[model samples]
Target: MIRKELLSKCKEALTTRQSELIKQVQDHFGMKYEFAKETSGELSNYDNHPADTGTELFEREKDLALNEHAEKELEEINEALHAIEEGTYGICKICGADIPNERLVAVPTTDTCVEHAKNETFNRGRPIEEEVFSPNINPDEVTDEEQVGYDAEDAWQEVSRYGTSETPSDFYGDKEHYNDMFPNSDENVGSVEDLENFLAADIHGKFIGVAPNHDKHEE
Candidate 1:
């Protein structure tokens, strides 16, 4: 149970970091307010000009930015701690691999190993952890006429508008097979547009819609 012990230590370290970050946030804000108060008081005297006000502003701004980022890390760490407690901590969100200890030490909130983690690129304003499994679930690749909400009425409408009403019957081959199956009505090149045209027409016929632009034409 070395993983368990490391996980606990990692949680403790993160909690300590969270506490430290909160104190730093408070101290930085206090420093800024105190400086501002002093500057305002001196300005009220009408002749007092601080020599390093610009430098102070620059330093304060940078420190404020850093503290905010640290605070955000604390948020992720808290989430990670909860996940650990819930016994859902080490499983990779993408490939279901056991996350390595080194990675846990480096980024305890992470839910994926390096390989799967590489597939997921995202930006964080602070220390980061990512969960890349949910929206990208199995068959996140399902792209079809049915997925785009297209029915025969829509195909009928497109054919009636651009080509011929008879084209729908000829294009789809028969109405009975596809009257319930629907058609692709993507705003741009649709599923129907791909298999029906292009150099890969024969390939598409053999593979339904695996034409060159199958993904592009996916509704």
Candidate 2:
């Protein structure tokens, strides 16, 4: 059962918050109007190019977002106050269980208990890309014997070749070139055997010959 004293306090808190939110919305609009009038100079934004009033447009959008947030919270507070009058303030909307006193005190505008509350992080779970992407392998977690032939780390190394934040000083040994800053910089890529680097067969597999500069690769 919800205590009479706590209910009274919750009502007082909600009323105070309601007034503050109203003032906040009014103040936001008043400032937004003043800013727009001062920056725009003209009667309408229709005359101005979108790019010309970039800063003013951005500020107006920001103010609108803030006002919307305040109005939404004010709406919640109003609903909570109405629920208090109906003697259902502390009950969870989903489960009908009495919300904990601590939770109620912390979030007086809340209609549901902690467990039943809509949590985006909990509901969303992991990233969707992980389902189809290559398996991410940590070098520290895997030994040489257990390592896969190619994994997400290898993919990263391939991409990192173009550019990375690492510097020559970040590496352990001497790194004279920018290209040598990445991990396993000297390792071969796209080929398993040394001969594969210089040998290739035609599409028909009828002509097998050594490629040019095969001696340099052999050395």
- Candidate 2, residues 1-219, lDDT tens digits: the string is 999999989899999999989888876664546645565676777788778689778867777888888989999999999999888899999999999999989999999999999876656566887676524455534464365476656677777878898887778988777866799866555455556657567668765766534754676
RMSD of 1: 21.1
lDDT of 2: 0.78
Against the reference, the lDDT scores of all candidates come to 0.60, 0.78
Model 1 residue 197 CA deviation (Å) reads: 68
lDDT of candidate 1 over 102-181, digit per residue (tens): 88888877878888775655764543332432232223433532454444344454564353434344455445433223
Models 1 onward score TM values of 0.44, 0.52
Among these predicted structures, which one has the highest TM-score? 2
lDDT of 2 at 216: 49
Model 1, residue 70: C-alpha shift (Å): 1.8
